[model samples]
Target: MNRVDTAVHVEGLRKRYGDTIAVDGIGFDIDPGQVFCLLGPNGAGKTTTIECLEGYRRPDAGSIRVLGLDPLADHGELRRRIGVQLQEASLPARLKVWEILKLFSVLYEREKVPWSLLDHLGLEEKRDAYFDKLSGGQKQRLFVALALINEPEVVFLDEITTGLDPRARHAIWDLIRGIKEGGATVVLSTHFMEEAEALADRVAILRAGKIVANDTPEALMRSIQRDDEVRVHVEGSLDAAAIEAIEGVATASIDGDQLIARGVGRGWIARLVNGIEAQDASLLDLSTRRASLEDVYLALTGEDEYSPESPATEEAGT
Candidate 1:
């Protein structure tokens, strides 16, 4: 696609701090109204790459464009059309939710009102609450509201829902969908495998400051291996000859009383069932599951060294 048509574009972007190279040569694109998630572990350079795109940090090399403006050279123009929620952002403790929203709105060329933004985020009831008085989830919602106050064309969210409860996390997911539906492109950094699989239209897996893989979640999972697994629980012991009779059945193994058949596609499941019936083996329970994004992440990046903790987790045990 043309660079001009993309909401955010980066090419061979590099960043360094002293002797360390934080962001190596990496590149990607964010399409308009699409949720593009960047996944990586701590010290992987996801943050550095995002900061360069947001114009908060100047890159040592390469190029970046946000809404057709150079992120570093034309930051003033870009800022007018882009909203950002930094990972370390914090508001004054005494500031009321409504006041904080109103303050940030004034920074944008075109702004949405505090109440309207809060209503969209399900934070209308907390509008008058002090920033420090709000819960972790409430603060996250308010941060999101402030980011969108400018009616920006592109929104940058860094670990936005990292510390929320399951209910709150799902709520934020719905809110993110609403943002995409409102014609705004979203670029976010998240370590949550399921979160990327659920919200992102496309994902880029970053490792050591470089993008190792980029594609749809489904495609990535499928690329790992061609084999599909079927779990079958039968009333009695399964015969090896009968199991081998199923078409496309590469292998069958017994784990406790459950028999697992591995092969290609859904056809193997039916063949295995029919073969079992032919042998007079009664079927007890059957289930089929696809490879998830977690499997894909582990295959591509190895297991992450740092397990990201949510804000609530940090707060509760501290």
Candidate 2:
């Protein structure tokens, strides 16, 4: 892709600390108005890569361009055009949310209305709350609002939803969608499989400081041939043979009060429902799970869901 047309461009990117290579000669281009995500486990170099792109850390090697400007050489110009919400952000403890937003807006040449942003982020009620008094999710929203105070062309969000409740996380996801809808290119780093799947237009999965896979969530899942599963709770007996007889079903079994079917192809849920309806059993609850970004992450990185249980820290080289 042409670098000039891209919102963010990186080529042969490398960063090292002592003997450890935090980012290993990686390269990718992000298009304008796209939601690009860096996904991996803790210490997989997601934070390091983001820091380099944000001009906070100078890369040991390679070139990076945000909004067609070098992040390091044109730090001042780039800062104005790009917004960042770091993995860990800080502000004066006594500062109120409105005060923080106003403070950041003064630094930008083109300022967005602070109250509008607070309203959009659902922080209108917390407008006067002190930074130290806000809950984790509220603080996250405030950080995001500050990131947008500049009306930036590109935004970088690193692990923005970590440790938040499900409702808050989903709300953050909606905010991300709104950011993209507003025409800002978003580069976010996350280890949460669902977050990447839900928000990323394209995902670059890093493992051991290098990109192992990069593609849209659907394409990545399609690249690997994983099976879909169907489960149904029935009021009466379920014939395992009847379910297994359905086309594409690899296996079927009755587990306690539920009928479970595993399949290699699509439309298994509809087929299973039809098959079950034909039987004497009454279907009570039914659900189907397809191959997800989590499956793709596990398959590509060779790491299980619980492998990297530790929280990411700067000292850990995340």
lDDT of each: 0.81, 0.85
139-206: candidate 2 lDDT, tens digit per residue:
88888888888788999998888777779889999999999999989999888888898999999999
Hey, what RMSD does candidate 1 come out at? Answer: 3.0
Alpha-carbon TM-score of each model against the true structure: 0.92, 0.87
Error of 1 at 71 (Å): 1.1
Residue pairs with colliding backbones in model 2 are none
Query: Which whole-number lDDT from 0 to 100 does residue 206 have in model 2?
Result: 96
Q: Residues 1-318, candidate 1: write the lDDT tens digits.
A: 123588888999988899988888998888888999998776778778778888988899998888888987888877877888834335788988888877777766444555687888888898899888988788888878877877789998887777788888898899899999999999878878878989999999988888989998889887888577778898767887568667888888877678888877657778888887777778898887778887788887876464544345552110
Q: Specify the highest-TM-score model's number.
A: 1
Return the TM-score for candidate 1, rounded to 2 decimals.
0.92
**Candidate 1 overall lDDT versus native:** 0.81
Model 2 off-target regions past 4 Å?
Answer: 1-4, 86-89, 110-113, 234-239, 255-257, 267-285, 304-318
